[model samples]
Each structure stands twice: as structure tokens, then as C-alpha cells.
Target: MAEARQLREYVPAEVPESAAPATIEDGDLTGGATDHTVWSCAGNLTAVRSVRARVRDFLARMGHSETVLDDAELAVSELATNALLHSRSGQSGGVMTLFIRSDGTRLRVAVADQGERAGEGGHSREDGDDFGRGKLIVDSCATRSGEYWSEATHVAWFEIEDPRPGLSLADTAL
Candidate 1:
């Protein structure tokens, strides 16, 4: 007889400290180059790749420098990966949503998942092993990043402060 193995899910360690959780409200993006777009896809293992690609393309088209574009892509990927691993969104028939907002000076990317994860034996961060713990990368590179939950979804997001607003790397003199 074949043995069935339990899936091991990974959740990232919490950020050391930040402001207390509060209401999630969208602020104004009052800048010349302002835009907001959202995308949704099946929240499975494959979402990490697709989400990263979309975010990269979206930011590229927004005329952001390569540094910001790369950092935003990495940050978004980290957030998405976390949402998938830690929430029910990673389960079958689940879905994940990506929210992006930019004001030519700063860009914010958010990933919304179904909710907290529940599995036979999925939560394991005490082993001292590392595979899915990368949320810190987001916190390190992003200018401002945090997470909040709506009634139905667990959302994590980060904001990048662009050093050169409205400038694309394509026209750089370097």
C-alpha cells in the first residue's frame, strides 16, 4: 500500500513590529501620472509567476525606472507567495487578486487571498528551515509596506518611493 503524505505549508515569520492594525482605506493618488489597476487569477502555486509578470509589465509601462520596477516586482512576488502559502488561497479552487496604485512618485502593490490557512499540518516555522519565508524582502526594499484584512480577504501590500518620478529607464543618459 502507498502512503499518503501531508502537505507542508510555509508561513513567514511576522515583521518584528509595525503600527497596530487599523481600518483599510484607500487614499488619494493626486499626482500627474496616477493610475490604479487590479488583476485576479487562480491562487495556486502558479500564481507567483503570473502575478510577478503582470506586475513587471504594468510597472514597465508606467515609465518607472528599472530599479523601482525590479523592486516592485520582487516585493509583489513576495507578498503573493506569502498569500498563497499562508492563506486558503493556495488551496484548490481558490483565487488571488492583485491591486496596484501609482502616483508617479510612489507605487503600491497588494495581493488579496482567501483567508488564513487550515491544513492537517501546514504551519511550520519553528524548524529553522527556510523555503517560503521571504516576506522580509518586501519590508526591506519597499519604502512603506503593511497589511490589512477586509471582511473576506487577507491582503498584504507594499509601496515603493520612486527617486525619479515620471522617468523611464529607456531614456536615461547612462
Candidate 2:
């Protein structure tokens, strides 16, 4: 596991409102409850796995459905990987921040990374296949998704609403 950076003073962030059902109220997804967390994620593959496992556990403890758990894990993995592969965060001593918030009904995840490196990014292995499909997977799974930049930080975020109990995720999508 990579060493996380020392914590910084906490400042709540807001994503622009969208058509999504759940919103982060001043970054409090639990509505004064207690389901929000921030992680100082090191830009590395190990952190990717840890982030996925942590997210799965977090949502699971909140009683989210398995499908929703799977989707959230997948989406976070992609965002973290993008930070590792496409931005300066993957460079030496680089770190990214992960924000997670959820109530029983809705969950939001975002990764903030140092913006793109000068002229260095991309995989060496390519055979005409899409090298990066992070956004595509997020688009399919999230109720709303978007990316933005603040200064030199790039933030990618996604939100999902749980399928009503007794309903499948596919059912809700329809």
C-alpha cells in the first residue's frame, strides 16, 4: 500500500446539480447522518484495488443492493485508474483525493487529480482497441456523471440512485 499524504483542512465541495435524484448537500450525503468520507489516495495500482474494496464495503454497510455495489466499485476503479494513467498524480510523490458520500438511497463518488502531465500519458500497449473506456462505463452505470477542472485539479464524478428494493437495477433503467 502506498503512503497517503497528511490530511488537509476539510472543505466541502459541490457538484453542479443535474437530473440525478440524489444530491450532496454541502457534501453531506447522509443529511447530518454519517456516511461521508475522504481518502488521500496515492496514484498507484494498489490504491486502485484498495479504493474498490473500500467502496464495496462502504456501500454494503449502507445496505445497498449487490448490483449497485458492483456499479459503484466499477465506476470508482475507472476514475482512479484514469487518475493514474492520464494525469500527473501518477508521477513521483503524486496523490489524488477521493470523495465518497451516500445515504441509503443515493451514492456519489469523485476523484480529484492533478491535471494532465505535459506530454506524457497513455498506455504503451495498444492494438486498435479503446485504450481507455472509463467514461463509457461510468455513463452506463451512473444517473449523472461529469468532469471539471479547478485550477490545476481535475475532478471526475458520478452519482447513482439505488434501485428500489424488490427491483433489479436493469428494471430501474427501463
Candidate 3:
């Protein structure tokens, strides 16, 4: 399993003291260079890879710098893969959705799935083998405000401030 850096340890400063929060209200929202796009896929694990690939292609086509595209795509993969592996619950119509957004100053990636994973706590790939706690990676890279939720539906997300000329991950690494 790939070692995920610890979230608390890699805290970035850009994360607000309260951690910025947002949502994907519906399925019809259109994303722009400074906005976001939401893509939903079925619970099958295969869909995770597909979502990652599509997101990467989309970012590349959008002309995002390689660094930004890779970070966003990695975050997408970790969240989507986790949704398929743990939150599916074998439900007939389970779906996993990815919300990608960039505010020019930062990028936010969110992954939501059909079932809740609250009681199980967050699982880590280091927890004895088959799965690694991908959230740790997300958290480490995300601003201090990044978070995860396991409500009736499972959702995990993270945010990274855009590392422009005057900004650095360290500056954002609260």
C-alpha cells in the first residue's frame, strides 16, 4: 500500500480556521475555468479509474498546468476509489460522484457515494493491506479546512490553494 502522509502533520495554512465549505446542489451545474464540474459514476470499482482518467483529460484539455492537473486528478482517484470499495454496500443503484472546482486561488475535489461510512471510521490502506486510508493523503495535501463526511451518503473532500507565484503549498500548508 502506498503510504499516505498524515493530515494533521501536513496541515496547510490556506485552509481557513473554519475550513471553507461548499456543495454541488444539483446535477445540472456547468463548470468554467474558475468554477467546478460534477461527474457521477456507478459504484463499480472500475468506474473510479474511468473517473480519474476523464478528470485528468478534462484538466489537460482545459490547459491547467501539469502540477495542478496531477494534484486534482490524484485527489479524484483516491476519493472515487474509496467510494467504490467501501461505500457501495452492494446496492443495485449505487453511484459515486466527483465534484471538481478551482477558484483560481485554490482547487477543491469532492467525492460522494450512495452509502454512509460513518460507523466504520475512515479506513487506511495501511490498515493491514487491501485498503489504504486515502483520506489521509487528501487531508495532508488539502488546506487545513479539508474534511470528510459520512452521512446517509458517504462524502470525502479536500482542498489545495492554487500555488501561484506569491503562494506555495507551504504557505497554504496550515
Candidate 4:
């Protein structure tokens, strides 16, 4: 993992009062809470490990053991990789940021990037397909499930159940 540079503080824009529940527009999806850690990452493959390391470290500070932190780090890596590869059809050169927050009961991670839109929902890869399985892995990581959403200049995030209750992040079913 490379060292992460401070690009800028993540300043969340407000969702309009009239915004619908569970849907966000023109703002950070702080994922229903503000007591989250924000990590700024450059929009390159190299940024993946740095962001993953940071998430695991934050979880450790929150009292998670190394074992649990490893699970979360794996999920963060996948999400960051997908964001860099699929979030845009061309260059993803701006930055990728990770927002991590947990409340003991669950842990949520949101990897945000400035790029072309990558829409919501999940898709499966046929046996021979060579690509497009990132979301499937992410879906399993979520304790409940995971989702994706996007807009013109930003794609916010998805959340999965943090590894707890004996549910390994990799053991999650698609």
C-alpha cells in the first residue's frame, strides 16, 4: 500500500429536505450517519491498497481485532478496484475516497469517485465470462445485501454487513 496524500477534506453537500428516503443526490451518502472516517484516494490502481489499509486501521481503532479488520480490508479493496475499473469508460484520474463507519451492530463502507455514472443493482457473470464479477463479491460481503448508484459526476457507494457474527466477508452469497 502506498501512502495516501491529502487532496482535500471531504465536504458533504446537503441532500434537499425533499429528497426521498434511501436516495441521495448531489451530496455524500454518509450512509445515514456522520461519525464516519473519510479517506481521500487518487483514482488509480495504486490507490486501492492504501485505501484498504486505512479502512482496516480505522476499524482496529474502533476495537475490531486484526482478523475482522482483514475481512473489511478485503472488501474495501474489491470496491476500490471496481470503482477504478468500471466507474468510467475512460480514465478515472480524479480520486477515490472511502467512507467507513460502524455502530458495533454493523459496519458500512462507501467508496466514492468522481467519474462517469455506474448505475445501481447487481449482475451475475455466466460461467465463461471473463469479467464483471466484482459486484457479486461485494454483494456477498454485505450482511444484508449491497447496491450501487451514480450520477453525472459521482458514484456514491454500497454497504455490506461487516464481518461479524461468524459471517466471513467472502462467505457472503451473491
Candidate 5:
């Protein structure tokens, strides 16, 4: 068998609370535990695959179950793709940032790009296949999803609640 291709690894640095994106509330999901990772990449189509792979690796290392793992990966993929396809961040030399945080019970994924202001209308395809389907996928997979805009960046995020062991979906009101 051929050897597997290794994706470029991103080493997340400890960002100061003040430097954290305004969209992401501090100490909210991590429960005061600052376990998070950040990846910066060119705002291009290829970045979507890289971000998804990184998300999978990160969540797996965090001991997430297979179901949760798949959802998280899909959610991130959709969000990242939206940023590239619809935002200025996808322009040449533009940059997008991916942030992932976990606190044992929950995980949050946020993608920030230097793009159009939130709510100022985003990109859509000519095909009449229901615009904004990305948010739909994110909504179905994540427990919560939202978007935020600052003077310089547009940030979209999703939060997933990891199912507790020995509990079925019917047992929890997620």
C-alpha cells in the first residue's frame, strides 16, 4: 500500500484574551480551561480540505466519538467553504483563520475572514438551489450556530455538544 499523505500541521499559540476575535466570547466554552487551536491559511478552495482535516485530527485527539467527529468535520467544512466562496477572504493574498476550542463537554469551531460585512448580503450561485444552504447544514449538525462581524472581519461559528457516555440521544435534550 502507498503511504498516506500527511497534512501540514498547525501549531496553535496561546492568544491573549484581548487579542481573541471579538466574535468569540472569552472563557465561555472552555470553562476557564484555555484549550484551543488556531490555524491561518490562504482564503482559497484548498484551505477547506485542510481545515476539515485539521478539525478531524484535533477532535479525535480530544477523544470525541465517531458520530460527533463526523458532525464536527462536516460543520467546519461547510463554514470554511462558505468563507472562501462568498467572502473577500478568498481573494488572492487574503487570509482566513480557523479556531477550535473544547472544554471536554462541548466544542466550538470558528472561521474568520476579511470579507464583506455580515448581513450586507453574501454570495449566491445562479442555480436556484436555495441559497444559504451552508448555514442549514451547520444548523443540522451543530447544537448552535451564529455569525459575527467586526470592522475588519466576518466570523462564523458553530458549537457541538458531545453526547455523554451511557446516554442516548433521547435521553438528552440537545
Candidate 6:
């Protein structure tokens, strides 16, 4: 078995006040000229709803279509659920973090949990299992998925291309 990776210590830098509300406090990981939003919460079941709401609000501010918004929200929810249910982050006093970044063309979502490995010792499911279908939903909606371990945390991310390019908030008439 492969040894688990450890998470590196990070200190969030202060962004300028003029920065966009969604600006990344941490370093940019999405490699795009776009704003980013981040959230950190206790690793518990309730964090799922909080993360989903934040994702919806962020996408709305970015003028994403209703379909895209729904897809992003669902994907984030699944990621958070997995962190809370399968990772060490779900333990008491553990933490989970979420990041969202978007350029005009694509949206990326990442969730990080303080886990030794990606879904380490997670619940096993048989072929006919009704639960544990979150990954399927994520794969169906996202154009791409990525996973990596940093320090003691496992990060899982997904990206979705914009359905309607060049549509700004003014264009949406919102």
C-alpha cells in the first residue's frame, strides 16, 4: 500500500480591499484570470448545505446559467458529503475547505479534507448498492476531475465548461 501524503502548512494572505468579493485569499490554483471564492468549515454533515449555498451564490454572481448553477451546486455538495463521510476531516474538530474559481469559459470547484488518503478506508459498496453514488453524479456533470494529496489533506476537484459563453450578468438581465 502507498503511504499517505501530508498537508503543508499554509497561511492565507491578505487581499486588497479592491479585490473582487470572490478573490482568492490563498494562492491561485485554477490558473485563470478569474476571481475565486473559498470557504472553510467544520467537517460535519451540516457543512454540506453551507457549501452548496455558497456555490450557488458564487455562480449566480458570475452570471452562470441556471443549468450550470444547478450542476455546480450538486457537484460541490457531493464532494463535501464525501469529505464528511469518508475522510478524517469528519472527525471531531476536523476541517474541510472549498474553493471555487471561474473564468468566462469554465468553472472549477475543489474540496479539501484533512485525510490521509483519498477516501481512505471508506465504506465499501457492492455492485447493487443504493448509496455511494455521489461520484457517478460528479462524473456525469463535470467535464473533468482531478485528485491530489497535499500535506495531510486530500483535494478532489472538477471542472465544467460554460454552456453559454460571453453571457455576462448584463446579458442575463438579472
What would the per-residue lDDT of candidate 3 be over residues 1-174, giving only the tens digit for each residue? 011122212223122333345532222223544323333344457776777787667655555556666677777778777666676522345555555555455555666565654366655656787665575666665563244443345456665555462333465567
Residue 78 of candidate 2: its Cα lDDT? 93
For candidate 3, give the lDDT of residue 90: 22
User: CA shift at 69, candidate 6, in angstroms?
Assistant: 0.3
The TM-scores of all predictions, comma-separated, are 0.70, 0.72, 0.59, 0.58, 0.70, 0.69
Model 6 lDDT tens row, 45-66 = 8879888998888777776777
Q: Which residue runs of candidate 4 sit more than 4 Å off their true CA positions?
A: 1-43, 88-92, 117-129, 153-174
Per-residue lDDT of 4 in model 5? 8
Q: What is the Cα-based TM-score of model 4?
A: 0.58
Best by lDDT: 2
The TM-score obtained by model 5 is 0.70
What's the candidate order when arranged by decreasing lDDT? 2, 5, 6, 1, 3, 4
Evaluated against the true structure, the overall lDDT of model 3 is 0.53
Which candidate leads the pack in TM-score? 2
Task: Score candidate 2 by lDDT.
Answer: 0.70
List ranges where model 1 is wrong by over 4 Å. 1-27, 31-43, 119-124, 166-174
CA lDDT, every model vs. true structure: 0.64, 0.70, 0.53, 0.52, 0.67, 0.66
RMSD of each: 8.8, 5.5, 10.9, 7.9, 7.9, 9.1
State the lDDT of candidate 5 residue by residue for 1-174, as single tens digits: 010011112212223354455544465764523333334444558888888888888877776666778898999999888877677667655566777877667888888766673466754656565677888899999987777666566678888888562344565656
Candidate 6 residue-wise lDDT at 129: 52
Per-residue alpha-carbon lDDT of candidate 4 for residues 77-172, written as tens digits (9 for 90 to 100): 787787676554224334555667665435667665545535734334663555676656665555433444334333334444433534444655
Show pairs that collide, candidate 4: 142-160, 142-161, 143-161
Cα error of candidate 4 at position 124, Å: 8.1
Candidate 3, residue 169: how far the Cα is off, in Å: 14
**Candidate 6 lDDT score relative to the true structure:** 0.66
